[model samples]
Target: MKEKKQNAVTALLEYAGNYKILTFAGLTLSAISMLCSIVPYVCIWLVARELISVLPDFYKVLNVETYGWIAFGFAVLGIIFYFAGLICTHLAAFRTAENIRKIGMAHIMKAPLGYFDNNASGLIRGRLDSAANDTETLLAHNLADIVGTIVLFAGMVILMFIFDWRMGIACLLSAVISIIAMFSMMGGKNAQLMADYQAAQDRMTKAGTEYVRGIPVVKIFQQTIDSFKTFKKAIEEYSDKAEYYQGKVCRIPQAVNLTFTEGAFIFLVPVVIILVPGALQSGDFIDLVTNFIFYAVFSAIISTALAKIMFASSGIMLASTALKRIDLVMKAPTLKNCHDPQIPKDNSVVFKNVSFTYDGSSLPALSHISFKAEAGQSIALVGPSGGGKTTLASLIPRFWDVDEGCVEVGKVNVKDIDQHVLMKQIAFVFQNTKLFKTSILENVRIANPDASYDDVMRALKAARCEDIIEKLPNGAETILGSEGTYLSGGEQQRIALARAILKDSPIIVLDEASAFADPENEVLIQKALSVLCKNRTVIMIAHRLSTIVNADKIIVLDEGHIVEEGTHQELLDKGGLYHKMWNDYNQAVKWKITSEKEAL
Candidate 1:
């Protein structure tokens, strides 16, 4: 908990560094506000003492014009300070939040790509929300309370000492004891409650995100409201835990303050009357009453400060946890490249004993895998699901670094080439076609945002999306539904193809680009594929073997091992895993066709 507190403080300072001016202003405003807060307390004393001094008989309440005027003047001063502090506090608090958000976003974006993969998107979102909450807590409670409490505590102590040393000593000791008790009790039950609440909130966030993203799948499977039970359970646990801990920590502080306040009054009154009566005179008695009032107000402020710290301690811990999580990602060492490595002179990829493993996994995804693809030459990766084919394809673009050997582009180590230069040479079309929720033209333009209308049209025609576009009233301007739900699977793939064409990169990675197409759509897609693959270094992962039959090489993977490597004709002649799998797949397709014809 101590370490977490330190880390949270560090993170806050680091984030706040960007808006140092704002932070300074906030501190100044808070101090000014605290200074103003003292006015009302002092005014009350002045009014009370003056009323006593002016009254002929203390019991008789008589008109006190000077007292009234003095009180009004003090009240105006108090109001001015109150509002000034409010405005400044808010300004500082909001600016701190804004700075944190900016830095947090930059940190996440600049982090390694693998960071995004290992952690859930929902979890990242949760931390962002947590950071904002933490900042608010720090500004609203920690910042304001600390400033106000110090001023109030100090002022009251001085006033008490001036009035009577005995009362002053008692009050000071009680304040110290209260603060010590608060710190001691705050860690155990208070921290536990906070941890429970944070855990519950994280679970709910994850569940909510899943519910939204998988709503369609859930409805299709007739599992509506699947998250309702979990949500209710989380809320219940959070509420129960909060109430339990709230009673545990807060009640103790309340008891401590009550005991000390009552004890001071009971023990000190008789002592003061005996020891300080001659010194008290009439003025001293008034001082005693006013000093007690000051002590009362000051004690409230001190108790409030302790309470703020107790609650904010949990926030600080959570924020620390979030910052550490974020830092782990942000500080991850991304694969860096040279200043200006030559763009692929030709789209030839060579892997020399390359290997890779996802973090925390014992086994490598691609083990000692080696292969080569020359410019304009096609290579097909064939394997059952989970056979490293996708992993191997990801390496060409340097998504994950090889643990053992190197991957080269145009005979140069990829690590030595600039990332932009390398990415410019490669275009990837994944099995799952992802279309943004925007106009089809804008979606395609993501590949090359500066491409002209003619360029868009040419690419669309090549991908056979022109016909589809012409059918729509808005043509390419038509907005896609969520993840292009408005379009069919085949149409989405065509749009994806159009994006790849717009990229016009020298090397292309096609992972099941046409896997979802119907036969008629597949025929058109195959034509588009031919156009896309023309004069490009292409590595295609084909589920349907027919797509890669004419490729220069077909490499088969079993588990993490490369079981076979050959051309389509050569692999068939060898009659190994590739041949048997190819034969089985062909038979299945034929059987499906026969069954469909029969149904027709």
Candidate 2:
């Protein structure tokens, strides 16, 4: 039951979809342009004929001016048709690119957050956006030219035979050889080579982006460009491979193709002379010479036409590779939505024997874990670094569906509930706070767009952001990430809390929400959390055990299993992982105090 693999051309056309009508129009116009393109050549032939008819008389041909005007008219028509074809093709190409990017973005939105964890953002952007751009160039610029050149090839063949079939064959000798050379050069092992090129480019792009984003750390560490292993290696590998590939594979064929095509007429002169006695000796002598003249004139143009084909073929290969990469993005699975979605009756959260494995991993991240946070209670998850605290909390919101067992909110399985409705019931505050590039007020208001300016202000105040806002020249109107109004980590963390407060969902999941807070902001953030978590079913993850000491329950986890669950003192009484972690935390706090006093 294997899926059939689509060729690159077919895949690209499928992506084009309904927009192909524009492509068809472009092709039709391009074909017309090709016919028109030969009109000037035809004019030359006609003028030659008239000139020969009045040989040495020089003034016998009347209305000779008419043919010149007609030739000019045909030339204008050819240019107009080609321009129109380009316009149509370009329109289709741009639209196709936009649609693919938009569609890819929409799929990424619906994909599991784990997808982001495994895939680099730069790699994804480079593959999708670069593919779209390559496709646009192929269809908008290359395809139109390809179609025009094909039509010209056909017209040239027909006209050559009409003039004289023997010399027609002679005229195409160089083109045929060039075509064979191109096929030999670009065909065998081409698929794998193109794929390798694309993969190398993607790796280089990912490394470049990572290096740029990490420049601050690099500068702080006083690292040289050569010390950035990934970036340096990627650049060198890409450069070396590209150089090797071009030098080894292309040099001979390209030189051969170019030389023979440009010199096709040289071969023709000897061939025509050899065939004249048999082919054109019985024909009128003047007619024979005239046809030879036409062939001589067309030989260079044939070379140009053949060259266009080679260029188009190269673009096709690149575009095909791009299309294949884009297809991979399109094929990524989205989270399934329930057809008959259930509604939750209350704000209680439950995980029952849930086992989950991350994509491309053999071991389960969470194994047969069970937990509950009853309505109007805050249950904090405490564990070592590799414990399943985040994974367990993530299950309730269906960030990933459990491979075994169910996660329920208010007695209904989370997967059975409508995704949007389920999201509406929960508010999330992550350790890494995310704020849009907008005003502080607008960022808070994103939680509830319908929330008024007054509502946002109240949330900001509750999250302890009043002092930060007051110092800004534009107050709430100042944009984030622009101008000179950048906030520290603690400040952004408060804004995140403000967003959660504004959301006011019945269920709140906080993953190390105050991890970024400075001492002064920590107290303010604690106050904000107390307000935001009031009467809500809260599932929180905190690295700082002191912050979660007053939770209704603390669940201690280790290596994908819950080791113990009870009140703070209750877990301390058990003398397990939690108890040891608590004892260590207290000793760390004492050491900090002792160190500070000694420094003073």
Candidate 3:
């Protein structure tokens, strides 16, 4: 058990990294300060001895002025040293926190898209930020408190023996009991409990975020907050767990610990009174009583010191949990790149009998999916939902490496190309457009930050977003989601298209760019898409069968396998899956409301 705790402490100190030197300096200074703090008590004992030597003639105490001056100086120096130590520790702590946050964000940026798919943005932000902040708190104040308390406790023990071992033992017994109470309360079971508590907190945060984002759907369905099962369940479970921990798990031990620590004097006075009479002569007994007073006064300091130690103990436990959470992201594998990278000579995309399974899943997302999209050709992947249309398109961008076979560009394996170079060669327009809370012009210019105002205007015009810019009060300078300057789904899509157009990459990947467009905006977005796709090699995943009728090639997939492949007319003649889907789509379009049919 002792070894386990030592290991945890070692891990935390190791994580301090470059700041360890500063931490060591702080600890050393804090120990010096603690020594100073205790020296004043020794001075007080000396003054007491001088007064005792004078006996009835109280005014004749020898060198009283010298003892008084020395004691005052020790007290003052303790405060100064404590302050200096804090300055060093806090500075080192801030630096450590900054580095951790930077390292965490860098890792997330390089992680695979599949990691994002399986985790919610809110969960990631909450867990990682909490972990970083917890570590910061530990380093900033908790660590100093911990080191100071240990030093103070050691000083008190040594002085106890020097003054009188019997009295020292009496004073030390009170501290031992307090320590026992603290440790017993947070026994072996607390580790698992702490883990459970953190998990519950994360679940509650995720559920709450999901509820807010889905509020529109909830209102449309006439749903009450209480009716949201996941959110409600999360709140209930978190509340229950917290209540159980506070009210039942550690409640008794905590109460006993606090009581014993705060009232240590109550346990001391009786023992002192009993010992004063029987141990020695009147003069010696007076000396023993004076030393007991030393123990009594220092007991208060001991209680305060141990309180700080207990807080540091809690910080250490919490930091252990935070580190485990951080390790999940830090240790996740990134896309591997070859030492010698090769450039693709052309924009042609090919899947050479590829297979892929999602992380933490047994079934393949795409299996044996072989196809070719030659340079300057528009290829559309159309299929039922969950049939791997989007998954196959994602592989081309190296979002996830294939489990079997390979995906290539210009006959070179995509894995062999540098990630930044691979990304520079392709542009994506997702169905759900994401815009930062920035000016319209800046959001559009994200594709090429170096592009000037005129260049951004050109791309916006090509994507048919001129009308959106004209309507905003600040024209293109207006901030998104501010001052009623928000755009509808269709407008956001066009702005996204403008971003893609600005990219001007050799390959364009569109995932139903017009999925949320109204009948009016659909035609405009389609027109913009035509402009974007004019000469680039395109791979599109569209739910709308009619829109991709003129695509250079259509691949129909089902359950991770390609079932059919052809153009509009050729597939219709073959009477295959695409032909059946086309006929079904036309029937749905022709269907109408009963009232419209009756009126007609």
Candidate 4:
């Protein structure tokens, strides 16, 4: 626990260190601003003291006019100081908040993908926003509070001592005692409250994202009430945490500190007034009273400042935790051994004794997998669910590196090539099509931004997307909803295929694009694939065996190992695992056709 706390503090310091100059400037401006706050109180004290003591002396010395001018000058100077501090304080606060936000966002962008996946976007947003709030509050309130309190208290103590040492000693002792009590009462409780609040916030954020993402599924199944139940529980837990912390941890301690500090001043003020007169002159007594008044005001303000600091510090702790989560993800070691992979000259990929296990998993997804596909040839991966077919395809893109062996393209280790360069040589269409909210043109353009309008049209035609395009209000200019919600599964798949076709890379990977297509859509996709596969190397994962029956080669996998490799006819002739899967698939297809005919 101690180590964690230290690490948290270190991370905060590191994050803040980037804005060292700005922080120092803020602190300096804050001190200057608070220093100005003392001007009014000091002037008030000086005026009261002189009125009680200086007027009579000045009249006796025959200098009434000069004394009047001197008092007027001091009053004007005091006002000037007060406004100067206010201006500086606000300027510092705004500047600091703006700078921190800009730097924090830049850091977030530099962070890795895993960081974003591991942490909730809301929590990250919360941290940046809260940090900005804290910075501004610290400057606008705590800065003035702390500096004003210190200057006022110090000035009061000095004046009191000049009047009488014994009274100064009493006031100093009381101030020290008050500070200790405040920290002891609230420090630990605030820390725990902040930690709990942050955890609750993250849970709520996660649940909200889940609810939004699953809303379509929930509504289709009439599961809205069940979803609400889960959401309600999350919200209730979050509220409970907030209420518990507010009552027990934050507000109570502040109330206690304020009551005790104010109450102490009441008792201390009278004691000083009663005891100081015996040891001082008339002017000295007035000075002592005025200083006591200053101390009382300073103490009240300081009490509030400390409470606020405690609260803000707790928020800072929560922010630090969020930042640490981001840091951990950004620091996760990417797969190494990549130095300079040779770009593919011909479209061929080879997996040599490849093995891989996902992070924190005990079993390998693919074990000792070896396969070869020549230039412009298609290799179909056929297997049961969880048979590592998708995993092996992912290796081609270096999504996750092979744990034990080499994955090569054109006789060069993929790890040695920069991902950017390697990606340019290949195009991938995943099982789940991902389309951003944008115009159809923009979505297809992502694969090759430099592709001309004619190129886009040709790719669209080849991918069998012209029919979907023609139905749209604006054709290629039509804006799609997020993840292409407006399009059917087959339509979206064809759009994705259009994108790959637009890319025109020599190597192409298709992960079950036909898995969800009906007979009509399937026929369209098959036609599109035939055109797209021309003069390109293709590796496809297929659940519908018929789609890949004519693939140049087919590899059958089960339990992380390839059980057989042969052409479709050759595999059937062997009468092994492939033969059985193919037979079952044929029977299912025939049964579906016969049932449809009978119904009609």
Whole-model lDDT for model 2 versus the true structure? 0.85
Q: Which stretches of candidate 1 lie over 4 Å from their true place?
A: 1-6, 57-96, 104-115, 129-134, 169-181, 188-193, 211-318, 482-485, 591-600
Q: Which lDDT values do the candidates have, in the order given?
A: 0.73, 0.85, 0.84, 0.71
Cα displacement (Å) at residue 423, model 2: 0.6
- Provide backbone clash counts, one per model: 0, 0, 0, 5
Better model by lDDT: candidate 2 vs candidate 4? 2
Candidate 1 lDDT: 0.73
Residue 244 of model 1, lDDT score: 66
Clashes in model 3: which pairs?
A: none
lDDT tens readout by residue for model 4, 1-600: 235435644454444544434444544554544444444555555555555556566544434345555556655654565455555555655765565566667766544333454556666765676556555555444444455455556655665566456545655555555565555543554555667777788778778877887888888888854566767688889999888777665576556656665554664566676868663855466666666665555445445544555554454455456555555434444544355456666678999999988778899999999989998899999988999998888888777777899998877788877677778888988777888889888899999999998889889999999889998888988899844439888888899999999998889999998878778888998898888888899999999898898899999999899999999999999999999999899898788444766898
Off by over 4 Å in 4: 1-19, 54-193, 212-252, 262-264, 273-284, 335-341, 482-485, 590-600
Q: Which stretches of candidate 3 lie over 4 Å from their true place?
A: 1-16, 212-225, 279-282, 596-600
TM-scores of the models, in the order given: 0.84, 0.94, 0.94, 0.80
lDDT of 3 by residue, 1-600 (tens): 344446655655665688778877887788888888887788788877778768889879777788788878988888888888888788777777667667878888887776787666766765577677777767777778888888888888888888778777777777888787776756676756756876897789879988998999989999899878999999999999899877787788777777777877777777777876775755477777677677777778867887898888777777677777777767766887679999999999999999999877899989899999999999999988999998999888887888999999877899999888999899999998899999989999999999999999999999998899898999999999997778999999999999999999999999999999999899989999999999999999998988899999999999999999989898899998888899999999998778866888
By lDDT, the best candidate is 2
Q: Which structure is stronger by TM-score: 3 or 4?
A: 3
Model 4, position 100: C-alpha lDDT score: 58
RMSD of each: 4.4, 2.9, 2.3, 5.1
- Model 2 per-residue lDDT tens digits across residues 9-97: 55666667788888889989988998998978877777787788788987997656787888889889999998999899999898888
At residue 104, candidate 3 shows an lDDT of: 79
